[model samples]
Target: MTGWARSPLKSAAAWALPYWTRGEPGRETPSDLFRVLYLGWAVALTLKVLGSSWDVSWHFKWLRDDLAPPHLINTVGTVIVVALTIVHGYTGYGVDRTALRLIQVGTGVFLVAVPLDLINHRVNGLDITSWSPSHMLLYIGTALMIGGVIRGWFVGAPEGRTRTVMLGALFLFCLENTWFPSQHQEYGVFGIHAWDRGEPYAEPILLQFAADQMGRSVDRNMVVAFSLPAPDYLYPVYATAVCMLVLVLARLMIGRAWSATLIAAGYVAYRVLIWPLLMVADFPISAVPFFLLGAAVCVDLAFYIKVPVLRAVVGAALVTAGSYLSLNLQHTLLDSPPLANTSAIAAGGLLLAVWLGGEWFVQRYRLRGQPTGARVSATATP
Candidate 1:
């Protein structure tokens, strides 16, 4: 390897990028090849995660003229996925299991979704929110993209770093997907007016509702006209539910050092990476720390509990509580307005979701590794 490639920062950068795989070409193992390809795909997914909110905010700030900056980035991400599919998705290549088959299907749906989204915008013009009937196609495509990766994860005999890293990438991407909607609650400049006084729980899209991007005149009437359905409470609930679920799954699969902590780390790293961009754009930073660190610490401690059920109980509580407190504290430090609903009603429900998800992870994921006859009922540890 060259000196640049050897540096820790450079090495991390290279691994994250979609770089050429050198050496004797075909001489590389399938595991090595898959790792390179999946990491590259991960890069594209990261762009999508980043762009999810960026796209929304861009439209709020400046109407789409002609696939300018945000749209262009969106194209780059889609193109990366398309190129990945073309390069690795050869006919009769190894991915044929029922579960893994979705990889090809997802790529197809995502392809279709792109043109449909463009046409949707063309026909209806840009709607207020991204959840229009056609825009939902994008979610469908992206969901399948994730589904394919999750299924492909176990299609064949176990691989090494390829599967391991992909699992981490999956956790990271899922975290981003779960957390993206929180942007609807607060983000950059547009977030300042994200909530309404009288109907706070509804969580209306107030950006561009009254004032134009120029920040001069106000039209309070437009708030009613431009308003869309945004249930704020569900934002954290859903994000936490999904996040807790995937992180648990990641822990089950990887069995590596600091599994949960690293999951939190990935969440933090992505937020930190984007903070500068928001700062440069003159938007208030609203990315709340998702409390992966505290959850991680709690999960680690949970391993020491002797009873399986008790361990899970203790672990889930610690993680959820730690994460909630961490986020509130972070928000306080930033002086940003707190999330709309942070009560135990929401937190407890999220806690239940994480516990249930952890239980499911231990069951479904564990089944694969053990012998068929040795199936589990309640015989697993946290």
Candidate 2:
């Protein structure tokens, strides 16, 4: 007889007890279970990233459909994430209490956002902008969920090739999530360019709706408004202050000399690879963030400075300069969005402030004789 047929409660307790015991907070999990759990996490996150990427491109090409293929793919990823979250909660394998709590909270938020987002769509005509509040909640939840997974894997996995590879992959996903919202401007650049060439990519209906919302006729002016909705400053600000900060964190967490560069390169490469694929699938494409790699390199170099405050200042300066130069080059070569110098300076200042604040917090944390970062755990033998 199956374990359940013998006695439901007893069998359940028996099965759960070992997992609970084996996976107590800060305790190493069995090798097999560790691999299994984190591998599942990797797969689920990959699906979500892929789905979300396709979904954005899909939106640019067609009208919103609840049962669109991209949405279906994203739903499948969500289902897998829900299953993984349940397993993590029940067994506590591969995650500490803090990590588990983050995962739970994030998943809860994402689930709640789903129905709310649908309601938003029903009411708001077309939630075309990725910067909408409801959509941001989804991104926030995903960031939280991914952040938890990054912590769990960082702390629980023993130092080895496996850990390095897994952490790098996770950071790449994190970078992707961090940079996702900027894709609107990325897509918009090419979108307007295409329209100027008398070959707009968005469907006529989508263009009409977008124009209608702004009380304008469906013309070049409407397309310009629809395509480049956000101000130019927002893009560079996000690129310098927000996204590059993620690279800095990845460098610190991975504790690798080139971790930030590799992760940024991987993200850029993924975008490039997907560019042609999306076009072949008859979807809209966006300008890839080639400048990210240059900024990432500067971030890695800054980490070598040893002194926290000085490191932050120098790093922010380097990244700001490099990113501005790179953005200008891209604009010249590929007709990408030009980086405003004023915006770059503002973003750099913001980055420096945040970095200094982080250093202060870490110093305080150190003074308190508490662990500053994730706790390293030993791996248990099977």
Candidate 3:
């Protein structure tokens, strides 16, 4: 019984020893190292959700409405994200090279199909639409690529079919939300308008209704008799909620401390450096609030991951100063008073208090049964 129990342990050690010392193909190799990169992908996905303000839809709307070419800054940002996905996906494919080939081909197909479909639609005299099958395919392909890479790292194997199917389903759901009218429809709430100009078809009816209540102009945005419900209330809310839930699940899976810290830092860098550069070129004034929110979330998450004491202190100081400067710059650029300056200051203060409180709690908790910091330090050392 003892011999049997020890056998597997000995075998594992034997397998690991050669790989570590001789650099042979064993349980650990270059492939293994690449697999570990999935943690970065997880972090990127998390920050992508938290940082993005669903304003990309507006960007797309502007592109279509204005008949302008794609913004170079946005194109560059998209290219970077796409490159990361491809690298992450390739590493994932390394796990099960042969099996994943077919899956990769399918993924590539979907990615290409989306843009082609959009082009075809435009060529057929339909309006160049932002929300379409192609866009769904692109998003789904990216998600699948990220998800498969992460799962592959853990399982040490490919999850081709499952990843593909799951992504396809997600794509369909997103499509439904994109195409469907929102549920919040109130008919006759805003009075109807006449088809011809200078006609008061239902003006009296609306005015009478308004006078009986409070005397406000009836909502003019409503169409002839029926108007599409606001998609804002449901689509974005549902999409964000589900994305956050998925992020929480992914966080549970990748629980290493150092990896989390690196991921947080990478995300912080991306949001602070990349997102604003792209968005600000077009909508300079309104971009401030969005950028600040992204910066705050990134900094907070980075702090939570707990870097070395000196590094953490330096990072915190830089983030605080940068945030303050950014807020003031925003106010100056936009020609308005600082809106969220107080809240930002309060949040920074709160973060400092939490860090100090946590340190005290840890020291006190350890000192209850041991010789203060010395014994705790000794125990913590490798």
Candidate 4:
């Protein structure tokens, strides 16, 4: 198992070292296989989006009207895209790390699975249930991508307190939209409400209304649709304030450790709160918390966790749980809708309080002035 795992790392080093050391900066962008894979996946998603939009019955009627040979084009296109993504991720890029490679591969697999599941849903009329394979795949893919970006690509180290703080902040920012009600009511981005009210191609017509209106008389349909009362915007404002406060607390407590924690906390909070709201509300916005969070967490964990095995386990578990919670929280919360998951919520609050309190304690003790290994390392590393 170890040998098999290490193979990708050794191969990546052999492939990347020469290019990284010798490649000219402006001559051409360095060809990281993962980047190529990312592009390929993006292209696939674009195609899927196009196909889905064109074939409205697949979405609205939930019937595979374009079920003839032409469907093969979509299927084949999807399969090829998924295959490329998996291959790209499996082959570690620009770094020789077995664990990271595995994560990449897993992420690729999940990415591939999302489209496949959607395709299946279209073809077979699968009951769109929460926690379905497709849904799980989407969540997993999101978490992996966010973790990777934050920990692997940006922060360079995940375990450090700085990385954690930064990650938390980022999460909060991305998920901030969740606390707010869907903007679809205000902007006819998706389409006019009539279009949503069984009106065919309401979105295109709404767009036309915007173009025609050009700040002229507002379309009555658009106005009425968007005019529905929603929760006070102040709630999100307050949430944002609280989120920022948390980041500030982390910064004061962790110092250089602030960045990573902020990013992580922000990412987690967004995924936990915002993304699901948008998706559940069926707003026009794309839910991308997973992508951001996955990239962030992967990079963060890489730097933070010293023990490889423990890092892998904890990172994987958190990614999975976070993704699940983020993706399905609306359904879970709305369906059963716990008024009091008090213990869990309380635990989280306690942890935050302790973390903040410790920061205060350390400051009071003048730990900043005291010569400690972290301080010495911080000073010496730069």
Top lDDT: which candidate number?
Answer: 2
- Judged by lDDT against the true structure, how good is candidate 1? 0.56
| TM-score for all models, in order of appearance | 0.67, 0.89, 0.35, 0.32
Clashing residue pairs in candidate 3, if any? 114-134
Which parts of model 2 are misplaced by more than 4 Å? 1-28, 360-382
**What would the per-residue lDDT of candidate 3 be over residues 69-167, giving only the tens digit for each residue?**
333333343454455445434433223332233335535655586468558656543222234456556555544554444333333423354333332
Model 3: worst 10 consecutive residues (lDDT sum): 368-377
Per-residue lDDT of 1-382 in model 1, one digit per residue for the tens? 8776579878666764443333221222355555556567678887777666566555544545456676677678888877766554442222333323455677788788778877776766545454466666666667677756654444432556655666677767766665554454454312434434332211223344334532435343444333323554554455445556566556655666567678778787877777688659854355455555666666656656656567667766766676666656756665322454455356555666566656665566452321222111122211
TM-score of the candidate numbered 3? 0.35
Per-residue lDDT of model 4, residues 1-382, tens digit only:
6998899999877875554333211122233543443445445544543343223222221222335333554455467555643443343332223224434654576658756876876754532222346745654554444333322222122245443444443334323322222222222222333345554333444434443444445455544333322223322222222332333333332334335344555444533454355446453322222323432343344336544345444443443333334424532433211112223333334334444454455456443211232211112211
Candidate 1 deviant stretches above 4 angstroms: 1-36, 86-90, 94-99, 112-137, 153-163, 188-190, 193-229, 281-285, 290-292, 299-313, 335-343, 350-358, 365-382
Top candidate, metric TM-score: 2
Encode model 2's per-residue lDDT on 1-382: one tens digit a residue: 8766779878656754666543444465677677777888898889888998898888887878999988888898889889888878776677777677788888988999999899999998777777888888888888889888877876667667777788889878888888888998888888888898988899998888877878889898887777777888988888888888777767766777888899999999999999999999888899999888788888988988998889999999998988888888888888676457778779899999877776675455231111233333433110
Residue 329 of model 3 has an lDDT of: 69
Clashes of each: 0, 0, 1, 65
